[model samples]
Target: MKLRFGLQARFLVAMALVLLVVLVMLGVLLQRQRLVERESEALSSDVIHQLVDGYLHGQGRELATRLADNLANPLYYSDLDAIGSILRDQKRDDLVQYLMVFDTAGHLVHDGSAEIEGYGQPMGDPLAAAATAAAGPHVQATAQVLEVSAPIRVGSERIGGVRIGLSMAVAHRFEQRNAERLRGRIDELSQRHQGWLALMLLALLAVLVAAAWYVQRLLVRPIRQLAASARRIEAGDYSVQDHGDTRNDELGDLVRAFDRMSESVARHDRDVRRMAYTDALTGLTNRLAFRESLDHRLMLLRGSGRQLALLFADIDDFKRVNDTLGHEAGDEALLQFANRIREAVEKYGGDDALLARFGGDEFVILIQEGDVRASATRLAEVLVAELRRPLDIHERQVFLGTSIGITLFPEDASSATALMKNGDIAMYQAKVAGKNGFRFYSRAMDHAVERRVHMEQELRGAWERGELSVVYQPVCRTSDGRVVGAEALLRWQHPMLGTIAPSVFIDVAEQSGLIEQIGPRVLHAACTEAVRWMQLGEGEKLFVSVNVSPRELRRGDLPEVVAECLRETGLPASSLHLELTETSVISDELQAAALLARLHSTGVKVWLDDFGTGFSGLSHLRRVPVDGVKIDRSFVADLQRDPDDLALTTAIIAMAHSLGITVVAEGVEKESQYNLLAERGCDLVQGYWLSHPVSASEFTHLLARRMR
Candidate 1:
């Protein structure tokens, strides 16, 4: 029959071997203990003697060095009384046998005596030569004494030396006493160790027997249960339970903790999944979840002759609301907008439709069940109308509108990424045509988007390539038709595209954050050109008007930028005019007013450009600190025939003059328009009838002509 060596049996065998080894080791240890103790006593005596000798030497050296430093000044001054006093003080120590001071010539000056018997006598000791020659404390031991010598120096020159001798009698007695004590301790320890060994053998045997039983009953059984539970958890089973362990021990605590951890993991898994797929603000599907669903639907609809529509919606002028009000109001607006969109989608879109908040102020919807185009169109229309309704935010009614773009699957695009791109392009087309409407994706829209992207890329480095230049349009006194100043206009002549208009590239620059860089360059160029025109005018004060973008004004650096330009170009501040539109100032009237006030302090003029085109109210004129207003071309185009245009123009000039603001009419192409503006007391006029925008050199010629 085969015998099984279970845990208890193996433990018993191991314990027996250990007990046997312990008995043999104890016997051997007892036998060798006496010899080791005898040898240890002799070795300890030697070590103690050596340690005592070294300590005497170190003490002698330290005393000699201290004596040398004290005697230096007294020896230099030849004060024998001070030297004798220092030696006597050092000799008070019990270990110090003698102390002496020597001159550089090796003569003993003081030997710790009142009579100074060795004074001015040559040192006859063998160590005298080494003491005088050494730079630091030196020690040597003899049969009865330890001798130390140290040099005394004033600055870098050695003038004398000090010597000290310590007696060996006290050190020898101390060594002998320590050796006797050490022997007594060894004898006592040997007896105690023998008794401890016997007791340990008995205690170890008892513990081994008890451990075997404990392992079989408590440790092994609990460990096996824990291992089974771990295996279950590894196999995706999180339902863990404690097996009724009543012991208040680490094992019991671990079992309870494991159960809690399993429950926590299950709850966290659900929370993580929800957070990954849902938008926290709107409770709608997020972009990741929407994209995943779109891809899955596309796979199922493949080769099934079915279609799907993806619509992209963006809130129009949403940033304006955020900038004017706070983000809390913006969040409230978004929540309300989302609720309205959800209602509209439920009404128009079929059951299979999915809606998602793609990102900030942008939402996307997918419809795959019904007629894709018809359903998307109805949904887009309903969304636009419903969103246009005023929303109550912060107890104030705020109106919002949405622009949506629609693209169909298997026709406009096949993949999710491509469909999304086409939808975005179509949405931008709607904004460009006029916001608050919808547009369907077409090939032409894609091309237009490509061109715009291309233009933006090219505009980045156009200035470095020398493709940009400035043109000047002369502003003449309407009463005399004589040039007084010019408006600096930026023009870009692309290498491939002949001449790109400011309207096209200016918007691209602003959108791409390139205007902040380009705005300063234009300011500097205009100031530099105006200085030249001032020289050409022969003492006439000719000003240059530079257009400031709304983005640049919002940055609140216009005052500093203008000051820097004037400083660089040496242009007088009064000779530079900065032009801003009403829309730019109306966005943040307080900020604009402050910026304009700062510019006015520097003597630079601020003009409200494109007036009557936006917020043409008397309150705007009162709030903004403008020095002048420019009548937009739309008002000037029909100034000759249209009664309303003429009346509005007349009223604008009268209102501006009443407030001490000058009026300049733009787009005066006909003689009749100039005559009417001149009659209306317009201060300045610039249009095709007077002269087209010309190069700087050409404008210089006109200035010279006016000078003649």
Candidate 2:
């Protein structure tokens, strides 16, 4: 309990003890003060004895003679007056302050008053209890006065008593005179000790307050903070800083220990949360967190009947950044990519924006409000611009870019995962169109994409299921309208989705790596179908042509693929032709050249399909050994209406003939176009002007009909 009361209380207790001692000392001094008066009585007795001796030596014979002469005529108090006069004239200061004379009956004769003050006014009280009839002087203190009395004898007559009624003035005056001298001595001592007590008191008080402050800071305040911090930390909050500071004291040590503890708790809490919901290095939301936020917002939007939009972004050449600049730079680029996404989100109002970095260079944002989300193209455009800017770090500038896809809620899907899937599909379209662009999700695109996906799955099942078929489109001569060759086009009569477009399904098959199987199937079928015409002697100088995509050409197995097909079908190499588009030749020029050389060496002709239709280099044309060029239908179809088409057609025919390359004009719908092509010395043509894309039986029947 004493410890709890603290130091200040202890100080107050100590002060009370000091005051009690002062009061006790004052009581002792007041009790001792009465003794000084007894000493004064002894002193007065000596004074009176000296006066009697003077009188006995006839020291004042003249005063006695004068007094006797005045009293002879019957003045009773004359002698008393004469004696008082004699005593007053002597200047006996202490002895004569109070004078009282008594006749033998002890009645007052000449008592002194304060008008004659000090020792001359009064001495001591008479007829009081402490005074007795002793031969010496006696002193008493009465209610009224201090009393001193002595025997007064005139020649043994014992005429009266000599008494003094003394006032306190005399005793006080004596004390004051002595005390003045004592005060001078005390002043001297005090000068020697100036500022000592007050300075000590101030210094003691300052020390106590400083000690209290130190205790509060190092222990009390820190303990309070530790309590508060513990509560916050317990509540899974790590943001508050512990304000207690360390010192070279025990309490300070304890406080430091607590700070370290709080730091540990906070770090562990953050790490746990991050492990659950955050990407460690990039500090973005992980797949799980993204799904959670996405699901929650999607549900909210569904309930409120509000729109939610999502944008998915993929960086162009992201693998190259990882491959060329190293993985560290790749990670930094991803960070920068995320930051750019965040900036774009800020414009859309971050409250409705749920921006998160997905795996690699992929990212997603969920938009809650329609105003900002209504135009995802604008947001994607901003993202594209921002992402393409240069990132300067460590004095090195690096360029990065992104392709974005936007999928709107309900237009795409109502669910989070569905929205994300739609965005992914749109992103693929963007990538296909070329990198560094943006595409919006659409129902038509989705259906088109879904058809392709179904076809891809069917193509995967093609070899096992036997669902692939080939139809022949004949290549005929423009001049005589005679069949030169028949090109094979593979078609899939899908079991579920009927007649999926070749444009939609072929690319999907290639991406799914089923083209290798499908390509040979078409080649083998075309060869088998066309071989009957030659063996039966039904047609002359006719060959089967098959288009090879880039996937097949890059396999370096075109020669092997053709050899395998020829071995299986028992067809001559002269009766076989292979067609390729401009992209197939341009993407892998040298490989296409070498592969075409081997195919040409085998006596199988090669044709360029859709010439002047793509961004292909003319240099690939000379390199890759090929026999013929087929003008795109677009050029031929517009030849009558467009002068530029006529010029382009004329230039292409001239260039093909100069290279010993045969030219096949694709669209010959009008007699004027045919006449123009024949005049230009175009080698061959295939269109309604001569014949349409025909089935193998139709072409064979036409050949039989034309034999006449």
Candidate 3:
């Protein structure tokens, strides 16, 4: 039957409606939360201000009324003492602790309670302090900030005002009411929203049921028919016809198209079978079908776990086939050679074995046997015997020998790649020993991986012998010819080798797992020196930045180290910056993201060092909090003369500004180079353009000279 709306269209509409409902719910929830927060803040502020104002106005009016009464109708010391006692009884209960009024002369006139009347808590005449329309009530002392001042005006004759302070004991009573009300309202609103959500979901359920029935009838039926036909095709039966297109809908059109596809599929399958199962030129079983057949045989023999020997055979002196008989004749010789290998394997290795052209002029065979060595020796001899056969190619009789490398499986490794690698290594050994022969693999190759271990041991000692030192390159600001920060670089001054370049030792440290020790020490030393200078009154407002490597960042405790160093050295976080290589940020994306997040949390500035050298520059930057980018010396070294470097520097500066990160150009060797960086609007410029690395004392002296 024809349908007005198809199953796919119904599904799309259902999904769209569900998503729209979800978005609306989320928006409504957020709006409600915002409104509640805004209302609570406004109410709390109004209560606090009104509480202070009411108390102050009431106390001021009472003080004035009592003082005028006391003056107009004389009172004795006996009555005054009674009033002081009354104020003491009332101070603790009401928020009004003590009320005092000062005249224009800073002399206290009327005091509320005896506790503060004589002690004098710095209350002067209210008339002396100028009144501003925008001034809000503020506290004079931290412990007494709860107290508030309310100004009172009486015509043009401004008199003294009262100051009343409320203790912090009433916080619970005031906040509990607001919180309870909010929770109740939130719960009620949540329940109503949940009911609305359930209604919407029930409506969606009806749509789902109708759509499921429609799909079962229209789309699923035709697709199910196609799936059955596909299974029949896979089972080598192409007799099924496409009956999916019995109607005029989309599926019916799909079924009509499928009928044409089956014929082409049958033709391609036949061609692929001939090409894949049979060796194209030699007409032997090709490697693809050969491996499949071997796997099936292996499955039957799974419990046996008997010895399986693999032999990797290579053409001996095969270059002669191409050199003596041209490439076309060489192709013919290779096919004939493959035929001979099959015949040999069949004779010595039996029909149960596997024979395949492993790759390029090489072939592999697997055999199951009780005595692996015996089978290996026989297989090798048979291959040598078959390869001795003569090939007649274009009126020439050419003879090619074979070199075979045999390795036993289950004794080596059960994995295919490992067995292949072992066989290939043995084949190389056989060829090296002498061609036209075969050799079995032995287990002595583990000793070959020891040289790398020895190098790591030496690196551990190098850092312990006072070999590590820092080189500071000034990162100067352009608006003025002043230095803002310095990039800390580590250099190793080996006793025997003079000065070693970082490129050489850095990789050694990374491979040797020495970065964990080296990275922290460098950062700590840099921070210590910067702090020492600041304490000595030499370096002020100078930030020292150290580079963090990926290995160290992952393995080392950077957050604790950064915090501890800042605490230990007494250096402010703003004075210490961390420069991370962009490669570190991109290598392990997740760890880089988490590590960068943690580092940023410690309040230290982070710089993407060597910014332009990494792939996914912009994407990685978004995943982390970055304060700046350090343009690598690699790009800046030739910027004065190279147009590409100049353009890149300009673009980097602009990109950094767009992201709100500062950009510092390194390797500015000349004044003109520095000028170019400054002209490009770089935030900082470093390198020899300012000054080379100096000792701590010399740097301090230089700072002193510059100040002079």
User: Best-fitting candidate, measured by TM-score?
Assistant: 1
TM-score of 2: 0.50
Question: lDDT ranking from best to worst?
Answer: 1, 3, 2
Q: Estimate TM-scores for all models.
A: 0.63, 0.50, 0.38
- After superposition, candidate 2 runs with Cα above 4 Å error: 1-307, 313-370, 380-405, 410-414, 425-468, 492-501, 504-513, 536-540, 554-556, 588-603, 617-626, 704-708
lDDT of 2 by residue, 101-204 (tens): 44444444554332333322322444532322534355554444455555555454444455454444554555465555555655555544444544655665
Relative to the unseen true structure, what is the C-alpha lDDT of residue 216 in candidate 3, on a scale of 0 to 100?
Answer: 76
What is candidate 1's lDDT per residue for 522-542, written digit by digit as tens? Answer: 999999998887776356598
Better of 1 and 3 by TM-score: 1
What's the C-alpha lDDT at position 262 in model 3?
80
lDDT, candidate 3, 96-208, per-residue tens: 54544433333344465545454334444342243111132333322332444333234433343334445444433444566567656766776787678678767776776
Runs of candidate 3 exceeding 4 Å displacement: 1-455, 538-540, 588-590
CA shift at 501, candidate 1, in angstroms? 2.1
What does the lDDT read for residue 348 in candidate 3? Answer: 81
**Poorest 10 consecutive residues by lDDT, candidate 2:** 66-75
The residue pairs found clashing in candidate 3 are none
